[model samples]
Target: MLPSIGMALVLLFSMSGCGEEDRRGVLFKGVVAPPGIVMVAGGREHTLALMADGTVWGRGSNFYGELGDGTTLNSLTLVQTVGLGDVATIAAGGLFSMAVKKDGTVWAWGYNGFGALGDGTTTDRWSPVQLQGLSDVTTVSISGYHTLALTHAGTIWAWGYNARGQLGDGTIEDRLTPVPVAGLTNVVAVSASTSGQYSLALKSDGSVWAWGSNSSGELGDGTWLERSTPAPVQGLTDIVSIAAARRHGMALKRDGTLWAWGANYYGQLGNGTRTSTRAPVKVQEPSGVISLMGGEDHSVALKLDGTVWTWGVNDQGQLGAGRDDIDSVIPLKVLRLTEVSAISAAWTHAMAMKQDGTVWAWGLNNRGQLGDGTTTNRNIPAEFLGL
Candidate 1:
């Protein structure tokens, strides 16, 4: 049996601890995008920012040296990552980080228990090390412990943890080196869930494909069976972008419509219901959305008006709902947050870049992941001072 879920879901609890208290994140303020940052990303307990000058800055938990600064000391302020320049893209996994240089070379550091560093070994790195046989890479994505890289040639290669087949390599075995993904081409983008055992890819034709754990129907395949190979997400077309979390998948269509499927234990699916679904359901609110981001068990939307909104679990203000320890099954505006050029949502905190180039952050500050020179969690957005 599927077991009883609230409303239209099942399963008593997420095997990955998707309970009432597990969801949380930091917030940011000040319309915050500091002058040169082109992008931001977060791991389980750290953050990284890429600048227009092709350099990287980071703060928060550096345990396992995810900050790539050759140390594990957490930072309450942004610190430059050592020995990297001309970086074109950056990504963070649970406790590791990776970057793609302008020349299309990939480099990684931090937690290597599952060989997420892609150096063909299970050893931690305090500094960035280039991966072998991976070049001309255009971008990369990281989930809990696995990673996916998209090359300039429009092909996908992946490595690291694959307990749930998130690698799309037609096997469940973990990899210490990059393996070409099967049956996918002209791929424009890919996303690996924060901690879920699944991955998603968007092709140039506006179709989406998914693989790995299907528990709670996260794969959107109208079934609960897990897959080691890629499968098309049914009924989705014209998808411009996609995002994934621990147990759900979100998509934004060309028409600005937002849709989601999978676990709704905390209403992370954002369909005005607490029930999970095996098929796509329209997000009740948030129209004119230009982008979508998925936290551990929450959802974030960036609108055409440069405004931001969030919903689902607020245990640590991951929803930025203006108060802590609350959960909203429907969309709620992130109070007074606007003119945001971009946003990065993660397991315990979030960062936003404003039109002015100042970065702001909020949510769980444990380990100083908020990078506001404090370890206090914010129920609302807070400006990160002193850059």
Candidate 2:
């Protein structure tokens, strides 16, 4: 169903006026982006890519360096995250690695424990530091150890591991730097969760908001009680796209449908049912989805015809589906992939990008994160030519 997709970080603040220049050089609001391999991120096994000439590339587990390349030593080849170049967007957490350059400023590298590398302290970087209070910052999100930033002024900034409040700011304590998530304003888009607790936002009026630890309901807002602030995710609205994982959360509606809510055990809310639900609920067969990712248990979509649909936990295959013991509550079909533009998933592994940029990966390649040098665990898709 991939109907000509592209555009995954979706935050749009207008401004493209002076011609073109944002291949990660997002400056203030132009967001231009259209060149090659715009985004891909994953952490827990490590993998990253940002190129449109902005530079930033990585491979599997660099222990704590999370492959920012300063040397925590864990490679499968593909390197180059050192001094950084334009780097418009790239994020991966739970082990750390973040970038948001192109001048908006924000950088980080590998696991800073509860500090999530906000850079104020907890110290764990091996390279790429810059995060000092954040700057123009257009986009950033990191699940499972906290991190969220979105700033062309629409507001939102948070820092590492906030227990269950996931840094929403009303307080679960634990931030090591940047803070401001209380009232939330224009908030174009944001998503955080992978075990780091919870979060979700997207408001240009499309409405969808949520805040930390709903135990298993994942803050879809039907109520499991746990929000340090934020709140509105009930039936959803125009919702262009959203995804969160630590339990579950998925949104996408401007007619293309797809909805989800809270922990489905291992079903990851594809809607075929593993029970858990707190509010929304629609995802079943694949749809025109466009793009979405949220993997701790699983959920990935990309349709309109580019073909790539996944469902919950395929154990180690992460549902590429050709094998790996089975676990789909609904959406499947990921084998040979297709046009796929971009996609990313964490923990169990999944990565994709190929509008000629190549790169494909499958679940749990142990520490090699499927760069193809192999730690072996693919239920399907494999091509990953280095970066």
Candidate 3:
């Protein structure tokens, strides 16, 4: 959400956490917001923003209280998430949210029908609740009904939905608490699909591993079969990052090249084709990429040059090219956007964070996930009000 004009005008001043006298020798009291937002993430319908002050704000779908505002009311404006602070990073799932604080503790809220909350129960939480027995967490990732946490020690822990073996514990049983992913160590990153049916992990050794559903070959192990444990993604190495969609997977290699596999019925593979591959296929785009994100059937990439590109499904103008529902089988530069520092793609919408710290959004906004204080779908990128 963008900072409102009233909020911007009311910003008296911000002080550091140390409480030392500022060089300006000025002070203010009873203020909440910090300087600006540092990061933004999009869920199935909700949106989450992390401010420089370490607090989180959420908007959109709150039927299951994914907003974590201690209420089930949907919001068109941003609301401070209840009881979350000192947060280092945050992740949003299909109907849930997770945050990792500076103290290394993890917290979760929202839908828990499959025990995705990791609170030892299948009850929904309307507010942030400390995830039991998880600490030293370096990062967290969430999907439809599960969550994954990477520890400073390089081990991977998973919980929640395990159907299709997404939990990676060599079982299909749902877990209410965290469980160590069997046979995985030195892991640097992890990702889960929006369907909670597949998962991927990147190791420090530059290798990629995958498990869970392969109904569309999302596991990318040169097979169309599901695995209850982690398996090396065929022919992919020297990888730096990975992303998982509902039925497809993406990997960014150290060379800045992108690779993809699995479902491509909508040309999500970005290979100028709509064929599904059981093994990784090189994405048809120039290198120099810094990051990539996958939607349920589309993909977005942020180049090192600070430009954003997207491909695949555009039924909702998700490509941000001002085109009306025209799918692209190749990467298309997002029209009129530059200096993007980060990007996120949801089930049908997309978001971008400019280097200047302002947020922009396009595509599906039926729930005001765009945070522009409206529920209109955008075919072109527009400044989202209230950072």
10 residues in a row with least lDDT, candidate 1? 1-10
The digit string of per-residue lDDT tens for model 2 on 1-387 reads 111111111122235452222322332233222346777788877787787898887776765677776766666556678799988888887677888887899988877877877787887887889977579989888865778899998999998777678788898888889899999899899988777788898999899898988978888888899988888999799998898876888998988878998888778788887999889899887777777888888988888788889898787888887887678888888989888877788767888887888878888876666878878888898987644
Give the distance in Å from residue 364's predicted Cα in candidate 1 to where it truly belongs.
1.0
Pitting candidate 1 against candidate 2, the one with the higher lDDT is 1
**Residue 300 local lDDT, model 2:** 87
**TM-score of predicted model 1?**
0.90
Instruction: Judging by TM-score against the true structure, name the best candidate.
Output: 3
Give per-residue lDDT, candidate 1, residue 302. Answer: 91
Off by over 4 Å in 1: 1-35
User: Which candidate number has the best lDDT?
Assistant: 3
Tens digit of lDDT per residue, candidate 3, span 1-387?
A: 111111111112334643222412222123334568978888878899999889998888776789898866667777778888899999988888989999999999998877889999989998999987899999998987889999999999999989889989999999999999989999999998887888999999999999999999999998888998999999988999999988999999989999999999999999999999999999998579999999989999999999889989999888899997799999999987889889988877889988888889888887788888888888788887777
lDDT of 1: 0.82
**In order, how many clashes per candidate?**
21, 12, 6
TM-score of every prediction relative to native: 0.90, 0.35, 0.91
CA RMSD, predictions in order: 8.6, 16.2, 8.7
Ranking, TM-score, top scorer first: 3, 1, 2
Candidate 1 residues 1-387, lDDT tens each? 111111111113232554311221122122232346688887777788888888887777666778887765556667667899999999987878999999999999988877788999989898899999999899998886889999988899999888888898899999999998889999999999987489999999999999999988999999998998899998999999999988999999999999999999998888888999988899988899998988889888999898888888888887777898888888898876889988889886777778887767777877666767777888778876655
The CA lDDT at 17 in model 2 is 55
